[model samples]
Every structure is written in structure tokens, then in C-alpha cells.
Target chain A: MGSLLQIAVRNVVRNVRRTAITLAALLLGVGVMVSIRGTLNGLQRSMKESMVLAQTGAVQVHKKGYLKNVLSSPLHLDMEVGDALVKRILAVPHVTAVAPRILFGGMVNLGDQTLFMATLALDPKREFEVCPKRRDLFDARAKAFGTSADGMVITVELAKGLGAKLTEPAALLAPDKDGALSGENATILGTMQLTSPGERKIGIVPLPLAQHLLKMEGRATELAIAVDDLENAPLVAAALERALGPEFEVHTWDNVATFFKDILFRQDFLLSLIATVFLVLMLLGVANTMLMSVLDRTREIGTMMALGVRRSRIVTLFLVEAAVIGVFGGCLGGLLGSIVVAWLHVRGIEVTMPTSAVPFVIQPFVDVLYIVKIVCLSGIGALVFAVYPAWRASRLRPVQALAGG
Target chain B: MALVELVGITKSYELGRTVVHALNGVDLQVERGEFTVVMGPSGSGKTTLLNIIGCLDRATAGTFRFDGEELGDRDFNDLAEIRNRKIGFIFQSFNLIPVLNVTENIEFPCLIRGDPKKALRERVRQVAEEVGLGKFLAHKPDELSGGQRQRVAIARALVTQPQVVLADEPTANLDSGTSEQIIDLMLELNAKENVTFLFSTHDPRVMAHARRVVHIADGRLVDGTDSGRAEVAAVAGMGAR
Candidate 1:
């Protein structure tokens, strides 16, 4: 085995130009695969973080039928947010914090102009605890708005549409649970700069004020839950469901953002397709090199055969040659790829997604195990591609091959 | 029993629509330790006969026995094993693996047979010394002279210590002096080590050194009492033709 490896290594080194070409192909293919995977991972992670931190926390708990009628903002499906329910939810493993929110549709009156808005009313301290980055969403003027329960914050676009100014008193009118007109007066404390299109006409108020105006003193439409780790959200949600029973529905952020999940699935499919193409190209390159090597060494192969070398040994020789190329190329490519990813991660890539108002930075990173997997895949791919060529080398008739050049 | 035997051997090849006969109905044998040469013109069956006897090829029709074992119906791999265990081959081109140095090249066959590397390396070194390549063990094929390369090939063939070493025009690519030295080396090994040597060569020098010479023409052996004179005449006649 050691001698075979020595011969294989020497054979690969015999033809410098051809081996370099094959190594380059493998290197580029594996490098691109790693880079693409890392960048996409970064993009997916960034998008999920934005969605979880600024909008939905890691998981959400609501009345069993609430999400079914979520678009209508059904007051009848609201759940009681009493101290006992909150304490029960906080008891679930992995659950870090929970914020109860009242979701409603209201109209902000600005003299002759009235603006329809989707609104969230939540306790500021609890919401901040559940979604740490939520504070970043508030504009400069609203930095102190969460301190006072009577103050409200509307989206910048909605405030502009209503011709409303910060610190100005506004009348918010909505239909209460009894279907009667209910009104509340509050000072527009500040504006929020939200990126998503749906949240452009949104407003936020204190939980106490919303509960009073809606005549539901202790009820909220949903409880957004945060877990210690984003990856554990689904497990925590399942535990919450089992703890809270069938009266409430527990959803992970991925389930709540259905469109984003679809986008993620599509991205993964596209990545696989790209990876397949690269694999095929790399296979062809390595196969071509091995076949050419066999042809050039036909007489040498014949000589070996005549010297009592077995056909199986000939096949092993060629396969080992390919493996050498694969291992070297894979390791070097993975190293270079990891370096590139790390560099990009440190100096993040800013991507301006069509739906987002400001560009988000994607910090690409490839873990050690992922790089190892890619290297092994590259090596195995080379071996698979070399089988035909190795078989061809082994099958050559000794007499004919000797007679050949 | 003869160390090498061939009875009524025939070989033919199909080139397009023409069936060319390369060898026909040749019977030959050589005892152990005999230095024999099968001499013929280029179109004769010298190489085909050597190939069959060497187990590198199978005759189209014949009874071939090496060391009293029949090999007429052996498969390719079986033939390979027989060749590996019992036969050694020397080519006209000195087919040493260019990447391997003299020691590695000499030990190639043993390595292929999975010999213990430590023991085989010592034997390979001894064989290299026997072939006058003791000082060039670390030199690759390209770094050696034509004679030195052929010495490497000879070392490789003799390292296996097979019953017979088949040399097909071993000195065909060398100058007269080198060819003389190579033939002398074979004769010395044959006389000293009792190693059987069989060669297919048109070189008169090789035929002169052989204890027995078999002449062939048009794929059949030509009987002559004066084998050397007859072959010289045959060569001159062919040149005239």
C-alpha cells in the first residue's frame, strides 16, 4: 500500500501541467461551493434575525383560532393576559421572556383627513426584554416614548399620511369588542422607521391605554415569546403548546413568516442546483485528466503488466493518483474558501433587498465541520469520476498496449 | 522437464479484412539454465513466440507448458499471476517507470507481489550491484545512459529470480558496445546463477552468445545445421530482397 501510494504520487507529479489543471478545476469548484453556502447562510441568518428581533420574537402564542382570523384583527379571539397565564408561559423550558400585545385596526383623525392603521399595543419593558433590537426600530424622537404609557408611536409614513406631528394630541378611534365605537386621546410621541411594506402604516401604543380603549382590560391578541437561542424556538414552542394546552396555538418565527420560509426553501433549491452543476464540471475535468494520463502511459502500463503487476493494481494506481489530486485540491480550496469567508464576515457584504428600505449587511461564515464536509465531498466526487478511466487503464491487453505508443 | 516449452504454436491477427499470420506451428523447448535465442527477421514470429512463452500473451492454438505446468487455457489474471511468479520480461525500449529511481524500478515486481519491503530492498540492492547499477540506485531513468537504463531493466527482471527471463530485442535500442555488455551480463548470470535466459533478437552478437539458436522465417522454423551461418545468409538474402 505504501509503494502504491508512492507510485501514485509520483505519477500525479510526473505531469506538472495536467495535474495543475485538474487541481485548479477542483479547487475552484469546491471554493465556489463553500463561498456560496457561506454567503447564503449569512443572508438567511440576517433576514431571520431582523424578522425575529424587530417584528415577531422567536415564537408567538395566541388563541387557537386567532391566526385564522388574524387579518381581521378579531377581538373575539383575544386571550386573557393575566399574571397566571404569563407565569405559566414563562415556566416553559428555554423561554427567556414573553410580551403580550393587543393587535387592532384604528383610524387616526387629523382634521378632515383620516388614516387607517394597523397597530400593536404592548408593555414597553416586556417587549424590550423579548425583542432586544426592537428599540433600534424607534426613531430618534421616540427614544423616551416608551417611558410614558399615554404616548403613542406611529410609522413615519403613517404619521406623514395623517399630517400628524410628534408631541401633538391625536384621537384614535376603533370598534371595541361589543362592536361599539370607542375612542382614546394620546400624544403622538414619535415615529418608527420600519422597513417592511406592511408595517409602513402601523402604529404602537401602551398596553394599558389599548386595553382601556377596547374595553378589554386584561386581554391581548398574542404573546410574543423569546427563547435563549433562536434554534431552540421550535422546541420551546412545542413545550409551550403542551404546557398551555389546546386553548392556545404556539408558532415559531419561521411558521409566522410563511412567505420568508418559502423564500428560504427556494434559495436552498437554487443552491443545490448550482452545486450540482459545479460537481459535474469538476468531474469532467478530473476524468479528462485521468483518461489522458492512461493514454500517455499505455506502454508503461503494458510494461508493468508484463512484469507481473495485476490489473487490480493498475486500477488502484490510477484511482490513487486521482485521490491525491482530490485531497490536495480539496484541503487547499477549503482553506482558501474559509479565509475568504472570514474576511467577508469581518467586512460584511451589504445587500439591498427589494423589500427593505435600507440595505442589510450579511456576515458570511463557514464553520469548520461544513468546510470539512465540502472537502470530503470534493474528494469523493473525484474518486467517483476516476472509476471509468481507471477501469480503462486496467482493461488494456498487455500485448496490444506494449505494441501501442 | 523443460523450463520452457511450446508445441505447434500459432498466432494470427485480424487487421481490417485481412487475417495476418504472425506465427505458425512452431515447437521449441529449453532446459533449465540454458541460454537460448530465437532469431528471425522482423516479419517472422520471434516476438509472438517469446510473448507466448513469457505468459504475456496466449497463442491462438498451441500447447504451452512452463516448468511442467500447462498454460494453454489460463485466463488473463491467471496468466498474470503465472508471469508474476515464474516469468520475467525485458523489453527493447528498457521500459523502466521513468518516475522511479533505479532501486524502486528494480523492486517494482516484488512490490507488486506484496513482498516485504525491508527484505525486498536488500535483494533489489544486490541485483542492482549484479547489473553494474549499484552506484546509480538513486538515479531516475532519464538521468541514466542507455546502457545504465538497460541495466536497470535487467536488474528489475533478475530481481524476481524467475525460472526464465525473456528478453525481446533487449539490446535493439543500444549501441554495439552496450549490446555486447548486456549480452555478456546475461551469459554470466546464466553460467553463474543457473538462471534460464531466452531472447528474441536479430542481433548476431546475441545469437553468437546463445548456447542454442532457433531460426524462423515466414512464421515457421527453418532447419539449418549451421545456425549462425544460415541466419547470416537469411539476413543478407532478406536485405537483397
Candidate 2:
């Protein structure tokens, strides 16, 4: 058996050019597989981080019916949690900080321009406990975020649309809890960037001002919680749910960002579809090459057959050759793939939001497990594709083959 | 029973819509140690006869017995095993595996039989020396001359020490000098080791070296004669020089 394998190796090496071509095909398949897998995973990781960093704070707690009818931003669905509940939530083991917030839909009036937008109202000082990065984002002075102050932070795009500047007064009008219309005038403190769909018109205000205008002074829409680690969001959400009980709903970042979740699911589907296409093409190429090899050496096969070589051994010989190609190709592919993935992983891919709808540098992640999967997939695919050709070579009648080619 | 026995053998090939009978109702026997040649014109079923005797192909409708065992109805793999164990083959094209050197090709049959490597190597060296290929054992087929390649094929056939060595038009592609050398090597191996050889050839000069000449035409045996034995004896006398 070892001798037979030696012969198989020699045969494969003897036809260097043809073997190289087959190897190239296999290597190409594996290379593409690794790159695609890395990119998808990296994009998913980046998107999750972006969601957590921007709007959701790892986890959130809201009134029972708030999320179901969240698009309407109904004041009646707001949570009436007291300071006692906030103190209790901060006591949860993994929870690092909590900030109560109110969400409302209203129109902001600036001079003659009026822009309708979804508004988030929160305690500016407590906001720093959950999202410390907002300090750099809003770039506001100390007094602008004062408690009970009538101040707001709007997105850069909204500020440009409103032609408003710092320390300028903007009027906000909305329907309050008793179905009466109310309005308030607030000064714009700063402008910052936000990238999700429909987030261009977002504006932030002090929690008290939002409560006063909406006639829901003692209530909030939700409480955003920041955990010590993002991975512990689900656990923290669970503990908070157990503490807050039936009236409240706790949600991890992944659960709250429905758009991000759908993109991730679609990314998975796209990767599978692409990988399958690459596998089938590689299989066809390897099979075609092997079949051509069998045809080219018909007389030699007959010679071996007449020299008392078993048909099964002939099949094994061809399979071993294919496997050599696969093994070598897989190794080379892995090396090249790892280098390319590492380069992209370090340098990061600059892509528009069209790919995953998140504008940022997506650094592709190359996992060792994904590399292992690529090698196995390529090796197994080569062996499977070689079967038909091997069987055909083994089935050649010694008499007929020798008499002809 | 003869070492090789073919009684009323017939072979047919399917060519699309028609069946062509390549061999028909041929009867012949080759005893141990005989250097037999099947001589006929082209398309005369000489190859078909040799294929059946070598167990490379089966007779469509006849009994083929090797060493008194009937081979007409054995399974494909069993017949392959019998071929590996009991017979060796040489082709006119000097069908040595191109990738393997002379030594590797010579030991190939024993390798197929799963013989121990160390023992097979020693046996291969002995056979390579016997066929005047001792120094060329490291050379590939393409690197050798026509006569040298055929010698390697002969060594490969004899290394197995089978009961019979079958060659199909073994000199068809060789020049006269190389053909004469191949015939002399076979004759020497026969006289010394008593390794039975059954080959097919149309060349009258090759027939002159065979101990027994079995003539076939259109798949039937026309003559089995000992007339070639006189020439064989003369060649054996001059072989020592």
C-alpha cells in the first residue's frame, strides 16, 4: 500500500504543469472562502459595537407596551419608575451605570425652518455614566448640560438644515399626556454625528424640560443600562428583569437593534450562498482535470491493469493523487489566505454603509476555526470530486485499452 | 494439466451495433518452461489469445485453465489476483510506468502482491542482472534505449517468478538489433530459470527463436509445431559467446 502511494505521488509529480493548474483552482476556492468569511464576521462585530456605542447602552429597560408601539412614541406607554428603581438597577452585579430617558416625536422650529424629528430626553450628567464618549461628541460647555436646563443637542445634519448655531433658541411643539398641545423653547448647545437610518433628524434635550413639555413630569420612556462588559448584557438584562418584575421589559442591544439583527442574518445567508458557489465550481474543475488525466493515460492504465494491479488499487492511486493536490493546494491557500486576511484585518476595509449600513472602517477578522473549516472543505471536496474519474479509470478493460491507446 | 490451457476459446467485441468476433474456437496448451510464440498476421486474434492466457481478458465462450484451475467464471478481482500471483506481462510498447525507474518498475508486480520490500529489492537486483539491466536500474524508461527499455520490461516480468510470462508483440516497436537482443534475453531466461514464456508476434525471425510455435489465423489454431526448437537449440549454443 505504501509502495502504491509512492507511485501515486510520483505520477502526480510527473505531470507538474497539470497538477499546478489543479492546485491553483483549489487554492483559489479556499482563498475566496477565507476572505468572504472574515469580511462578514468583521462587519457583524463592527456593527454590534457601533450599535452599543451609539444609541443602545448594552441593554435597555422600558414599559411593557413601549417597544411594541415604539414607532408611535405614545406618552401613555412611558414608564413611571421612581428613583428607587434606578438605585436598585445600579446595584445589579454586572450593571455599571443607568440613565433614565424619555422619547417623543415633535417638530423643532428654528427661525423659519421647522424639522420634525424623534427626540431623546435624558439627564445630561447621568448620560456621561452610560456614554462617556458623548462628551467628545457634543463638545458642550459645563453649564449647557445643567440639571432642569432647557438645552438641546442636535445632529450636525439637522443643525445645518435648521441653519441654527450654538446658544440659539429653538422651539419644540408636541401633544402632551392630556391631549393638549404644548411647546417649549430651548437653546441649542452643540452638534454631533449619528449614522443610522432616520437618525439624521434626532435631537437631545434635558429630561426635565422633556417631561414638562410632554405633561409627563414623573415618567420616562426607558432606562438605558451600561454593563461592565458588552457580552454580559443578556445576563444583566435578565437580573434587571427579575428585579424590576412584570411591568418592565429588559432588552439586550442585539434585541433592540432590529435592523442590525436583520443585516447580520442576511450576511450569514450571503456568505453561505457564496461559499456553496465556490465549492461547486472547484469540484467541477477538479473532476474535469482528473477525467482528462484518465483519458490521457488510457494505455498506461491498461499496462498497469495487465501487470496484475487490482482495479480498486487503480482507483486508490487516482484518489491519492487528487488528495495530494488537495493537501498542497489547501496549505498554500491557507497561507495566502491568512496573509491577505491579516493584512485586511490590520489595515481595515473602508466601505460605505451600503454593505452593512454602518459607516466605519470594517476590519476583517480571521478566526482559526474558519481557517480549519476552509482546509477541510477544500480537501473533502477534492476527494469527492475525484471519485467518478477514479471509478472510470478503474473500469477500463485491459484488452480494449491496450489494443487501442 | 498444462501450465496454461485454453480449450475452444472464443472472444467477441461489441462495436456499436455489431459484434465482432476477435477469436473463435481456438485450442492450445503450453507446458511449464516452454518458450511459446503465437504467430499470425495482423487482425488474426494473436493478441486476443495472449490476453486470455495472461488473464488480462476473459474468453467470451471457452474454458481457460491456469495450473489446472478453471478461470472461465472467476470474478474480476479474483482473476486479477491470479494474474498478479501466477503470471507476468510484457507489452510491445515497452509499457514501463514512466514515473518509476527501472528498479521500481521491475519490482512493481511483487509490490502489487504486497511482498516485503527488502526481499523484493534483492529479487529485483538479481532479475535486473539476469536481464543485463543491473547498471540501468536507476534510469527511467525514456532515459534508456529501445533495447534497454525492453530489457527492463523483461526484468519486470521475471522478477515475480510467475509460472508464465506473457508478451504481446514484444518486439513490434524495436529495431532488428534490439529485437534480437530481447529475444536472446528471453531465450536465456527460459533455458536457465525455466520461466515459461507465451508471446504473440508476426515476425518470422522472432518465431525462429521460440521453442514452440503455435500458429493462429482468424481466431483458430492452424498449427502447433516443434520446428522452431531446432533454431532455439542453435541459438542456445551461440548464446554463450
lDDT per model, in order?
A: 0.85, 0.82
Q: Fraction of native Cα contacts kept in each candidate? A: 0.81, 0.71
Q: Could you list the iRMS of every candidate?
A: 1.1, 1.1
Runs of candidate 1 with Cα error greater than 4 angstroms are: A91-93, A106-116, A142-171, A185-201, B225-241
Candidate 2 accuracy as lDDT: 0.82
lDDT of 1 at A134: 70
Tens digit of lDDT per residue, candidate 1, span A314-374? Answer: 8899998888888888888898888789889999999977765557899998878988987
Clashes of each: 0, 0
Model 2 stretches with alpha carbons more than 4 Å out = A63-66, A72-94, A111-116, A132-148, A155-168, A175-182, A190-193, A198-200, A214-219, A238-248, A354-359, B16-18, B224-241
The stretch of ten residues in a row with the least summed lDDT in candidate 1 chain B is: B232-241
For residues B1-241, could you state the per-residue lDDT of candidate 2 as single tens digits?
6888778899998999999898999878787777888889999999888888888888899888999999888887888888888888888888888888999999888888889989888889988998888898899999999889988988888887889999989999999988998888887788787778889999999866676787888878886453455554454445431
Worst lDDT window (10 residues) for model 1 chain A? A191-200
Tens digit per residue, CA lDDT, model 2, A1-405: 787799878877787898888888878888888888888878777767666766778899998977998888878878776888888998899899888888888888888888887898887877777866555445445236654388788877778889855566779888787778889998777776664555678888889998999988878888888999898998998999999899888999888888877878888988889989987887788788788889888888888888878889999988887777777787778778888888999999877674223347788878888788778777778889999999999998987677554
